[model samples]
Target chain A: MVSTARITRQEAEDFLYEEARLLDERDFFPWLDLFTEDAIYWIPIEEHSDPTRATSILWDDAQLRALRVHQLAHERNFAQSPPSRTVHSVTNVQVSPGDADNEAKVRCNLVVYEVRSGDHRQLGLGDLRALPAKCLYVLRYEERWRIAHKKVVLINRHMPLINLSFLI
Target chain B: MATQQATTQRGYAELVEITDKTFRVSSRVYREQEVFEREIAEIFEKTWVYVGHDSEIAQPGDYKTAQIGRYPIILTRDKDGAVYALLNVCRHRANAICRENYGNSQNFRCPYHAWTYRNSGELIGVPDGGRYPEGFSTRGLSLIRVAKVDSYRGLIFASLSADVPELDEHLSPVKEHVDLWADRSIGGEHKVLHPHRYAYLGNWKFQCENGVDGYHPGIVHESAFSTFGEFGIGNFAARDLVKRGSISRGFPGGHSTLEGGARDGRGVGRGLPHRAEEYQARLREVYGDDRAQEIVSNRHTFIFPNVFLFDELVRIIQPIALEYTEVYSHPFWLHGVPDDFNTRRLYEGTRQLSTTGMVNPSDLEMFAANQTGLHARMEWLVLDRGMQREEVAPNGERMGNYSDEVPQRSLYRHWAQVMARTEAGR
Candidate 1:
């Protein structure tokens, strides 16, 4: 029920920044609304490995995303008992034209600094981890820009990773 | 410092104390640097440690790098299709020969000085050969090979010690459990996908003890069970399996199993329903009804020292240090099952067991917490949950209730026996 206007580079950048803000703020329920109904939030184990054929760090559909939110909210989910305090810094956003005027492919560099806040000083919790990744977002305009797909390719994808119980 | 008594063989044997009523492990076993080093020597280096699966190196010249205790190894298939586990160090110097995790190559040329070795650990080429002394034979210069290499249903294991028992003998205690898992494919092969590797701040045996220790799922994994239950999403550790009668069985070796009392095994038909049905029917055709039913029943089996085979994935525990451990979780794909089914399996497996899975992170948290808590002056950690109710089966397995420390007791018994071995005993 809206115009099929072309999305600009500024609009894509703003959308990505807002998304990053929501994630860093831990406003998960509101952030979930930014995605399309058939959204695919993926963090692939390997950049080139087929998600259908290979294992992924995370491949959350709407149902899974909701389930994860529920899990995080549960009182006994000790993995996130203290909940990570994260600051996501997004930069170098480049919006390229998509197949349609209402769609665009937005690429950006993301660095998230996360620390498990509270009394635990364990290796995974007390330590401040800086996760760097290359993020690609497929945006579609339906009155406003909504993410159809979000892929975060971590730099240390093949290495031994620690507690990634939080949204990255 | 009193626990520093572990410098001797008898001291290692004393780490576990078992009476008719109770079983306890020394806290020093988790907190000591010396105990960890001795374990690498007396246990992992001496036992048949899993290296790689046969499916990973299906073709000739296929190769993968692995580690057994502290030693780096290369697992390769030669042109003749013979598999070998070779030390990855160069013959000339101690430089590593293969750096890549896995690939296919007939020969590996060292980055330093270009010394080369064939896939079967034969010295094929060496640069500047003329500089060597006269009659400096290359016979003994080949990559130092492991003493024994063997596989059971595609799971390869290697031993560094020549005095150890044969791999078959070592694996005999849990072969039936292994067969039930492997035979699920009907072709008797499992294709291991790329691993989801994660590290934790805890002793390696924590992973070993955690895998078969059935009591924790009801307590530690409360959120996961509750969440999955509310959504009706099936997982390996379901609540009903707890309410029903899942049992814990421990073998003579350190191996143990968490046998689900459920008929269809939890999470068996949750995803890819049609494919699951097809897989079941096909398994029944080859193995008959009773065997097929046994195959479908849940069995989370753990082999001694390193590997665990759950319904969804194969978990390899790699000990790094006294308080650090690395785990590799590889989702299993049935050989003849359609790719879609395997994909669903991967998704479900990783969903629960991956680095960021709903279940694994909490376990990691507990392991780290346990490691930190062991710094207390308290000396013993009890492993006596269902000891009174434990019964010995005809097959030699000690069976206990679903939430029992029987498996942990089994692990410690074997651990003490292995650690207590002396040069005279060998």
Candidate 2:
């Protein structure tokens, strides 16, 4: 059984920073490898709502993510010709106590500023409350820390949005 | 109305000298505040503007709020299943009654003064009723109803002008096209799956022109087309076949349609390695041999002013300003088809063509460039393509071949007519 108390706040912050680095560096394959096979990436369309009923900007299973990654890598994607550059800032990392032996809840505030094709874009500001975003190597010692779900709730839900090509 | 008259006079005189051969429009049309105000009063206020679909307010007390030009209107379904379009402002102090975008509600209470209205838009409560005079009647104070609220094939539309033509009359030639869109649904009932809405920083007319222009598909979407080709899906060379054929342009009343199939529709679909068989089989099953063949292979048609009903989806254009436009796209399923088929249709339609879709970003880029180009030193942009080929038919439909500028010209013609009428009233 993994102890929620065992993972320090600094360790959680480091994991988030590394994850951000992988994304900013366009190391998509490695970034995708962080999620479990069954893990979901959801960006909800409504604030504090379930993704099933309410529409989402993005709701991708592993296969969809793979296809997106493939498209991003391809040279023919016109929108990505110049490629999108992003800097993700993660802060306010907080760990909540978990009920399961191997699970713990981690929350962080995120602000992603992106620029694509010479145009500056304000991607979004959101809070990610991911459960079981496990410690990378410590999963064997504590099964509870594996990520079960990662939910992103953006500040603007109803407003019109441009492409969400880059990960948030 | 007075301001509408003055603006119309100026617009009519300017449009009179313009003809089917004219390509560049006066920059004044895009920049004049008076013209914009007149359009709100004369066009948007008078005509029946599409609001939302019946499915949006399916249950009793379900409501959605939208804007009709500059006026805020609420669309609500009552207990009796009657849908109404009423002013969103309260009768007492004119404060907005509902702040939420959409919700299920029994009654709306104005936050300013607590004036309460029923789901059907009837004023039900006034705080401290005894304070009012005896003859003061809440009966006359019910939420002011929009002049007309009607639905065509489950698509709801409302108009603020009492004198505007009937809904069916206004739709006229375009009704047939709209029917084609809804005919796919079982029981001939089509509902919006809540639209995929997005905004573009360009004039709304640019969107209207983009959907009808077949010339740009191959050029602007070269990247997407090339990707499809790499996937063994579609070949840009196949589009060359249509280039040899004449562009067929038709105008039915104020509505206009542009029709031209790919050189070989079957060949293009065949080139797409993925889902080709599935799409073909579904088409054959739904349309049955000959009919399905025709349905699957046809050029796109635009119903003037604000709607574009493509073979697979419908895009409704709402103008936010001369420089900003909002588009709402909804996918329609062929009635009686398998649920899996509709799901695939929705998936393909949204992923490929929606605002945030695979092909849309490039299209948006083109629109942005066009918007920027309009600011260039050139007084006008050319629209003279196919001017020599325009032919007037006995039925009043102006016909032109595939590569013609006739469709854009047709829209300007309608614009001129509406603006002229407003001028005459002055």
Candidate 3:
């Protein structure tokens, strides 16, 4: 149903890679810009959850997104202080048609490595948190491709989750 | 194991050092496996520990897994709606029976030997009953229920030992807080959302202490509070008030509460952020203004051993090892509140308390850091904050300012008594 020609897998990969790079570098504001005004970024504790009915690890509308972005940008955000370092390895980018004429659906695998360390030595923490996940993005082309909805499903969603202080 | 335990018991004096006005807990209490085992037997096994909310297993045949101390059990409701807690282990071959988190089933059949049990935990079917010797007897083969199960306003609690104190007696200190909270549930009750489970790479006691710990927020969670300040909604006397106008009470049996004293309905940790005029009006009409206001006041409570109810959150601490703990947080959705209000509660609950919670990461980090620091050969972990000003209320309850160590000392006092308990000198 996409109005434009079928989106190439490489282009879809580019969208995901850029997003990952921004998150890895803690470039949250620009990363947040990739989302459409009403876009949803969700990480369901249970797969295929209804965000309105069920709880999720991360369920952010644009307003909630702005709040989170503001928190991450705030100089006093200690969780981000000394900041968590993350490296996301994305693979198997796949693209399919979206529900709307301007939309593109993309799915990929993500393995994120995170470490919370530095200057906190007084109380003491150089903790490591790592996990793998599947990310599905519902993209819309408004001038350029922007995220309409994104869901990240962790492989170990059932495991007792540690601090997910960094972006997936 | 017994001899090594004897050696550890001898060090119990060194494990905890207490005075009328000061207390110091050794790092070993957080690091020793023997101490952990003793606590399982002396504290958790002997005391009444909270299991699940009654609403969680409301329907017949509804079941979910729960833990007592370290024993895994299944909390199931039978036909005709009798609630029961059965050990998850199977009778035959000692295998686990129920594997799923929760589901509706009148019977659970063990995959190991196909031993099936009715929802009431009766041994209804055997793979081949005739194959057994005549009258071998399946008399005591039903799933073992916890020793005693009681509830305080739908908050189900179970004691593993028959000698444990009555539920009301154990909850005496915080009974008023519990009853007030339970009554405030919009329709006189609330439902539990699926728990968000997480683990802290620290001892379980840290959670019991930290839930009502008023001293650490300004310093440890400064980043989170400051982050909230950037939003303009958080600077309104939250952290400042936490250090003042507040009183914490220590209960018998290692339980305690931190109660903030503002009765103006503007308290930060009390209720939903929305004006909630309709909700409050209904509450005022039902319970009257004085009672409703008292109920709405926030009470951060530790229900001994491992359960905490703070605001709308119910956190159950599961001790897995000396330095590892798994926690399950059940955010209650009030029955009478608007769906939108419940939705926001769920959203912000995740934001504030879940695995990736804003306020919790720093707290968890501090706990882990403390555990890491305990590796050093330190003599004691200082917990003497505000000991001088601790007051004994007229009712004989131990009281202190919000930012005092009185509650922690209260807990350690109970812990000390439990660790030293012996049935009439053995």
Candidate topping TM-score: 1
Model 2 chain B worst lDDT window (10 residues) = B263-272
Summarize candidate 2's per-residue lDDT along B126-244 as a digit string, tens digits.
Answer: 99989998888899889989999988888788889888778888776566556645654534465555566777666777787777766677666665565555555434442663565
**What CAPRI class is candidate 3?**
medium
Error of 3 at A141 (Å): 2.1
- TM-score for candidate 1, please give it: 0.96
Top candidate, metric DockQ: 1
lDDT of 1 by residue, B131-161 (tens): 8889987788999999999999999999999
What lDDT does the true structure give each of the candidates? 0.85, 0.66, 0.79
Off by over 4 Å in 2: A1-15, A26-40, A46-54, A61-85, A94-107, A115-151, A163-167, B1-10, B13-20, B232-250, B257-288, B297-301, B311-313, B331-335, B399-403
Docking class of 1: medium
By lDDT, rank the candidates, best first: 1, 3, 2
Worst lDDT run of 10 residues, candidate 1 chain B, spans B1-10
Q: What is the Cα-based lDDT of residue B54 in candidate 1?
A: 91
lDDT of 3 at B416: 78
DockQ of each: 0.78, 0.22, 0.53
